[model samples]
Target: MERLTGRLVQMYGNIVSFLRKCIFYILSVGLIPNHIAFIMDGNRRYTKRLNLMQGAGHKVGYSALMSMLKYCYELGVRYVTIYAFSIDNFKRSPEEVQSLMDLMLDKIEELLREESIVNRYGIRVYFSGNLKLLNEPVRLAAERVMLATAKNSKAVLSICVAYTSTNEIVHAVRESCEEKWDEITLLNSSGGYVPDESDHLIKVTDIEKHMYMAFAPDPDIIIRTSGETRLSNFLLWQSANCYLYSPSVLWPEIGFRQFLWAILNFQRIRFYFDRKRKQL
Candidate 1:
């Protein structure tokens, strides 16, 4: 009887899984986000709520992120970017900050060694941030994962660690300026350069090419978990016209239903967004 009961449970689980796959396939037939950016928030709050250890919340958040990536890839979304660690996160208590860094290092190393989501989906991994801010061990682990997944092109996963949009913009500006210095000097050498302005003024395209997220097109949808409606400096410039969705659930608690709701909402307004895209 026990064996029969086990078999029944397995059968029920399989049926549920099959039903979920069907629903996902049906949803994929509609307009889907080609690229999605996730701002994983409320980790500390989640931990506090559960009264867990200092870093357990982040571990749970990592699991949630991996599940979302699988669902996105299965739904044919080709690009995924996650705001893993923000630059302002350094302001947290030293022990908390160090715990997060250690957690990141472990996750990156696991992605390299384990047959995890990246490997299963042929996703190329990228770490986009000021790596210098990370300790040497963590930096090296990040680099190793990047190199390990460099050639896999089935999909792209960008993890923003120690990053903020403000810093990204500044980096782009500095890089763009440095690259154009020679051209500027040549123009000034003509000796009649206008002091007010010139036709060679810095163009928007110049800065865009130097942006960290330039490797992928602008995200079609940006999802921030947690009730906070603000962007928290995740992807400012790249998100000028992107659809923003904020769900009140914490990062670790976000599930398929929430993701499905986000995609369906995106579909409902996709026509309006398309019109806006053309206008822009």
Candidate 2:
């Protein structure tokens, strides 16, 4: 009976996979997003609603994220980003913050495994944020995964931890300025001050190149779960013209239905944008 049940489950999964592919084929008729970003919200609320142990919602939410990533890759999205941890999240109670950190560490290791979704999809993993703010163990683990996946160029997955848009912009600007200052110092050492406009000015492109998110294009769609419409300091600079999707489902309960709806809406908007461009 156990073997029969296992076969039944396998068959059910196979059917679902086939159906999903068929839907994806239909979706290909329209232009789809090359990049998508997710703000995983409402994990604590999901845990409370499900009467689970404290912090268990994050585990479930991780599962949902994997499923979403799989869907995105299968649908040909080349870039994906997740707001994993915010700098302000440290303001939570000590126990809760530690619990989240522990969870992040474990997940980072799992992502490095050979059979993980990242390897299966040939996705390069990038941690985009003030990684120095992470505990040593978590920071090192993130670095290791990045090194391990550096060869994967087919797809990209960016995890934003200890991050905020304002912070990212400031960090990028500082790095760009430092690079320019080094050049200026070298040039000035050989001769007097060169009062050139180009040397004195920092261009927008310079700062953008130093941005942690420079590896991927601006997200075409940003999905925030729990029906939250605000960005909350996530990708504010990169999302100048991106579409935002707010589903009513909590993070742990999120599924492909929400993902599909988001894509459909994004494609609809893209259609209008394309038409407007043609008129010009």
Candidate 3:
């Protein structure tokens, strides 16, 4: 009886702690970030813990993503980006890679059918990455989503699949070089020496405009799940001034409450930066 009583007491304490965290989050909801990004990590770990199938963790994580998106939108965040799959993830087993690709295509198709909720809320969906690497079906699905949500102005949601920050930067640089070469050719036709693409000078600003996320503002807050402290090659250019948070919970375990806690922590960081800027 005493052991049972002690277990009950511990459970009660956990409940109280959770309640206090929720209250704190509620009080700071108004200070949520304008743009947020998430590294949805640890689906495999969660699945292992539950002794479930390999893909079951990703399925549960997808549900968590849906919930978090609604919560973030309700909290007034105008933009959210999630690192759904990285370029390095292609190194995983062929079966696992195929499963992820199939899942992504399925999710995009599902989102299209749920147009009522998405259109009503004015959410625009974009897929960012080296899209050429994706299969034709997945590519077409992504294109369809972009087209369907083209007119949405309320919120922007970006899914990064087969993406890497370094690759993005390199692509941007190559594009800038091409543009510069074109300009040099135009000038040389009138009199100046023509420059090769490799010889074309590139500026950071020029490369920035060519990046996939160039149309959106830099992320204000970045959240990584499953206790990972690293960025893992997410938006390198855009994360310069971003606040980062890592929660021990796996992506599948995250929900509205975890979203709220991240926002509250972001508010605290924003306050600190604001004060520092004023002093300077």
Worst 10 residues of 3 by lDDT: 20-29
- Each candidate structure's TM-score, on Cα atoms with residue i matched to residue i, is 0.92, 0.94, 0.84
Candidate 1 lDDT tens digits, 1-280 = 9999999999998897788789888987798799999999888899999999989989999999988998899888999999998999999999989888888888888898667888999999989888889999999998999899999999999999889999999999999988887767877897745546456666899999988888988888999989777889988998877889899999999999989888999998889888988997
Clashing residue pairs in candidate 3 are none
* Model 3 residue 111 CA deviation in Å: 0.8
| TM-score result, candidate 2 | 0.94
> Cα RMSDs of all predictions?
2.3, 2.2, 6.8
| lDDT of every model, 2 decimals | 0.89, 0.93, 0.85
**What local lDDT does model 3 show for residue 226?**
90
Top-TM-score candidate index = 2
Deviating ranges (above 4 Å) for candidate 1: 1-13, 186-196
For 120-187, candidate 3 gives per-residue lDDT tens digits of: 57899999999988889999999999999998899999999889999999999999989987887888
Model 3 TM = 0.84
Which residue pairs in candidate 1 collide? none
